[model samples]
Target: MKKIQFILSFLLVGLLIACNSDGKNNSASSAAEIVVADKVLQNGTIETMNPDQPTAEAVAMKDGKIVFVGSNNNVKDFVGDNTEVIDLGGKYVTPGFIDAHTHVIASSFTTSGVNVQAAQSIDEMLAIIKEYSDKNPDLKVVQAVSYRPAALGRNPSAADLDKLGLDKPVVALGNSSHDGVFNTVALKLAKIDNNVKDNVPGVVYWERDASGNITGAAIETQWMQTYVDIGAWIPEIMVPETMNYMQGYLASQGVTSVLVPGVITPNFGISSEATRQDFEDIMKILTTRIESGEAKMRINTMPFMKLLDADPDDYVPFAVRMREKYNNDMLRVNSLKMHADGHYNDRAMSMSEPYNKDEGDDLPYLAPLAMSADVIHATIMKATSENINVVLHADGTRVIQTATNSIIASKKAYPEATTRHRMDHISFINPETAAQIMEYNIPLNATPIFTNAVENGKDGEAVLKKYSKETVERTMGLYMEMAQNGANVSLGGDPPGSVVEEAYPVWLFQQAMTLEQPGRPELGAFPQNRKPYTIDDALKSMTVNAAWQLQMEDKIGSIEVGKYADFAVFNKSLRDIKPENLVEEAKCVGTMLYGEYTHNDGM
Candidate 1:
């Protein structure tokens, strides 16, 4: 009887053990059933750019969206057996850079053309062009870009390019891209001659010699026609190749998204339908590349207002069609880009004061306003009425004032329109105008790169002459002032316009932090009012604020759960680096878009 009782007790103990094991198995299975992250990045300082959370030690992404952002230990629950874990090894992560305003397509074309951006002299430029021509014997025409007449000490003429002895047509575009020096062959190819009249006085026409003979130099709207003609002659495959290179370059610079202003500038003599179709063809190429995964950056493009006669009412249907066709996670078109004034460097910016003088011209030059206040107001009212955003290219203070006033009037007229209009290249703004910008909550998409270039002697004299010394000393970028005043100011490289060797966000950040020209410690653009921005401020300008300008705050520009996993990893902590050395020391280790690495230096 005792042996039987002991056996029974042993059996009971075995049954309890089995039940506990079954419970453990069930719990493990339940935990496994929870959604797992596709990728987990940890052991790094992550600047989320999310004011609510601010920072994190790890981030988990699932299906191309952030699922977890917190401490490293907290991310473990989101990690699965198949998750591709990346140990950052104490590197720093920040939201991917967003270029608020850029000419991506134009920049790509420049990249593919005879790149004379580095030529320091006319002789060097000619030699470079000769070399490019020699390499491509089959080329029917040569288009060189980023050629600075100031760098050459004078503008090159058709006679000068003829000295190169290239049988093919050749055109060298100025850094601004609004001006160009065409050789005799190019002039013939574009069909510009003595009889070619200037429809837009001072804005578009050929530069003639004293005898009124065309000198093969053209400016403003004329260059647009030349660009189209030259593009038509170039090989078709080059366009996609150049675009591919630009995408890779932008990825290296940590740019995950871009706003391409003015995709379709008016071809002065071309039919409206032809212009629209041309624009569509270019977009199709870009879309094909994006669909093929060759281009990873998100692009928001705006059609040129001039293409639709600068009448927003005329463009609403086109904008709607574009949005219907291309509005997606990767690309969008929902805005109209108009030029209120030309480039500041060209002394074409409409300002309150007249420019000092040109070398040969006797009278002080007052820059011409591209669009009248009334016209701008009408355009804005019409565009807003259609619920379409408008981005204006206004560089000078007067232009900014006009644009702001028009926008205000339009907002009042179209009370129901929820348009987030932006002013691009607000190079000059007085305190009063700044206040107006803040009051309206208008986004200023500025080109800080241009300021840096001016400070560095690229066009310092022109800027100095355009504005009084007192004005120069008081306000340059007014980055801090604008921000303090509740203005939404963002940065854009505006590349090829600014002539940076490479559009590096770190370099731009350095420029903002230093406010001093490279190699010119004595020459700050706004010496007395030079306010160096913090690294955080610069980052926000390139990321969060820029995203806000594009109305993409919900999707990207921050490392937060439920947002796209688009962030860049730096080799070193940006916060720890000295302000001056940020450009030199800071290197992008990796750039991720949609949870995939678009560029990985370590790889």
Candidate 2:
């Protein structure tokens, strides 16, 4: 997380070379002239996101690498007869956005099924399921994704899905991908019932009614991953095609690179030969697309280490093998994703304080699956030793502090390591832990949209009712402190785990700035005492800090002379627009990757 200074001394060197070109009359000087660009963009408001030379009027590129970055007048020297010159006419541009933490496979898989994200209640969800089932009679299992649990009014049961009147099994996954409800037919097929014991008891298990009957809800990955296995049986759920569609979708959204916390192949905690083959097949297709110039977004994928119980020896070497196999600019494998704790809605998160509301269990607090701090430290050390970055899925105050300490210990033990370790979905943290994370230079990735109380329905009310306002005020506004301290902070959409529309980088930025839900400003921002983040802080989190988290800062984060020609073009500069109006006013008109237009909306 150390600041990476991009030296502009190259600009002076280029000026010297251009100075030699002044003697145009000499016959022998033609061959010795400075190299011309393959493409040039001029007359634009370019925000480079680099501390030095933050703005530029023009940029020149050759062979996909930036050749020159300066004024339009100076860029003329790089214009040749074959160079394609784009007159920006004062369009606003920034380094193409990077999603530091996401689940491409899970998001892509969602595209293959029915989406009930807009359903307002259980009845409406049933209606959507009925319509989809009627349309796809040939399909054996009807799988749906992005259903919001909050909109359902209450915990969903098989009886709710039974209202669809479908004989085939039906499955509807939650937007967070943490909870799922299956129809009775589906339950029978998966062999889940009241007799089935919980994987981790309270933290991960089937939802049951007072009569001890299975409500058909599976919480967390223990049984929720059964959806993936069921989806595999459906022919329409094609991995290769769905992945391509997702890549294009991301490019259209102006996302040039993504760091997938976990690839689709391996079901969580279940790494088998078949899953490995699935991974290899997907990687082959991705590498082929990149080689064929068809893939626009760069991907940095990581293998999901066994959640809550990752053995360093098992996961670290597997991560190294993956890194060895996919060694390319377009596709990379350099990180291992470890789930450190459960989510808040399930009352499964390991928190420092007890929840006011309980799930009838005698225990007041839930412990993370990675129970031992020693185990976390050991895993971090192993990953760091192998030069593999670790992305910990840490939520709740206690686990966040634990994860931070483990990372700090690893860094202390291996001072020379540069793995770019990070923790994502950092929902809660105290000032002391935040200071340690900043001092340790640990990159923090936050999905700000998740913090919006209005969007989270009554869960926000539950938070207020469960904890004291003083606790919320102290821990909830940790990001503002980190931004003020100039810590390496990055943002991600975390699709399948977020509302699809609210997960885009632009909306994410808006959330970061206001910490309020769109269209429902009446609720106001949560933790009202906290000041909102500035536009610059949000932009840096999306661009440069994101690149640093991916360890690709030198190559693509900023619009520098030596960086790749990657940019996101907007109709209006983000700085000129209101935070709430960003999604509408600051539309991404074009997306450029490596000097070519990946998505062009006539810009």
Candidate 3:
């Protein structure tokens, strides 16, 4: 083929004379070759999260791949004086923010260190646990977390934990491991008495009312492990002061990647050899804080299907020994997660309609809890015959039709593995199960920041009181009707139970590019499931279809040339704002990866 089109036209005219070279290069003095780019964000507007030729302004990067992107008249031939010429005054770059579901080591223990999720009553959740136990009086136990108990429709007692003093131990947490609220000396340091009630071994219903006692309320994940077992008796310098309030809220939320479905176990017996050696010493202390730059994101973690044994074939040899001990790309282990039900504010979703009517004859189906749908389709056909990826948590539409018939019977019995399954909080689906979930190319991670379950549930006012007035303009997302029908979906931020109400989708991309929900004006019940979404289809359900569902689309998400240089910036122009000003007109300042600046912005 004309010598392969003359070696691709001499490598695109030697990459346009090395993008006009000033970017240093005695070409082969190796540090793994081609060291250029000390900087060059150039004129901005990049969005190279790529969808077949998406545009860019200037990208560059050298040692970490993306050798050059476009414009800046070929990146001003790598601007000398040791590079560094940002000028993104035009703002809006893309990629990075691959937080398709998060947790950053339990967001370094909830930022604002001890959140109590904006309490809203019950003496504002005890003035946020009496102002973090009166400003950490040598902390013995304040712990707190995403606690939402139906955003306070009730729960929190033992006289609201004897007015926060049974000589310490407060315990709030409920960003849905169902619910919690301890106090009576953190339920006698969680040795739940009345000589024990039902739920145990990873928590559930520590509930009680008229005289049965123990009403420091709780529902599941074993009564929020009596407030996470009072954090293994706290005081390890409050875990680096909760990891510097979780890397300043993931570098002011431009978050680069997290996954971490859930961890922190000494018990939950999900895995113990002391939690697989504290999951290989917390992935070697989050890969030595993402390698000495002090943790700036990129972690994948998994294990909590109550540590798999409801027999996911006896946890595929501890999911092949945590995919051969945390297989890297910046901290790893891709899947085994599990839940299948609970949370739409504890209607205990397993619904095939029956969250009421006397508990639809007493919890009639949220089944698949500890298995049975042919053992969760032979544990998703033994995690697609060992190519792994099985996540599964389903939120409504009869638990996403039991993970859409176990991903169409494990892609016809692993005819060729790679089911790379995932369902996570799929806030409702129907239309013959969204056409059998777009005929099995399965991937529906949704959580449009649970905008209070369609502005406060009852199936968000019955999907706008019976799809009225012209089937309320045809609706779309579930990842744009599974990518306009060819199916391939992604996105999730149900992290530490909905941080920024489900990790950064910028106010769920202004309610999915304006189906409207900012500060509700009266639940029009998903306006008959409002549709219309574009900003390049919600930035491909958050970048190159969430990095091809974490099979990591040729190195971290986008920006072409041999890949990697990650990305994210933004000061404006997310398609020139205003769908209720895209989350206060965008913010996530900077991020970059392989090529460094693990989290800047103030440039």
Give me the candidate number with maximum TM-score: 2
Query: All models: lDDT?
Result: 0.73, 0.75, 0.62
* RMSD after Cα superposition, model 1: 7.6
Tens-digit lDDT track of model 3 for 1-39: 999999998788666455543233311222233345777
lDDT of 2 at 501: 53
Q: For residues 300-400, could you state the per-residue lDDT of candidate 1 as single tens digits?
A: 98677543245555566787789889888798897877777765555667777666666677876777677777777877887788778889988787888
The TM-scores of all predictions, comma-separated, are 0.86, 0.90, 0.34
Between which residue pairs do clashes occur in model 3? 20-77, 147-174, 202-222, 203-221, 203-222, 204-222, 204-223, 205-219, 270-307, 350-366
Deviation in angstroms for 273 in model 3?
48
Q: List model 2 lDDT by residue over 560-592, tens digit each.
A: 867888999988889999998777677888999
Best by lDDT: 2
Candidate 2 displacement at residue 581 in angstroms:
0.6
Off by more than 4 A, model 2: 1-33, 134-138, 228-236, 269-277, 307-309, 359-363, 370-372, 465-468, 499-501, 519-523
User: Which pairs of residues clash in candidate 1, taking residues 3 or more apart in a chain or in different chains?
Assistant: none
For model 3, state the Cα shift of residue 592 in Å: 1.6
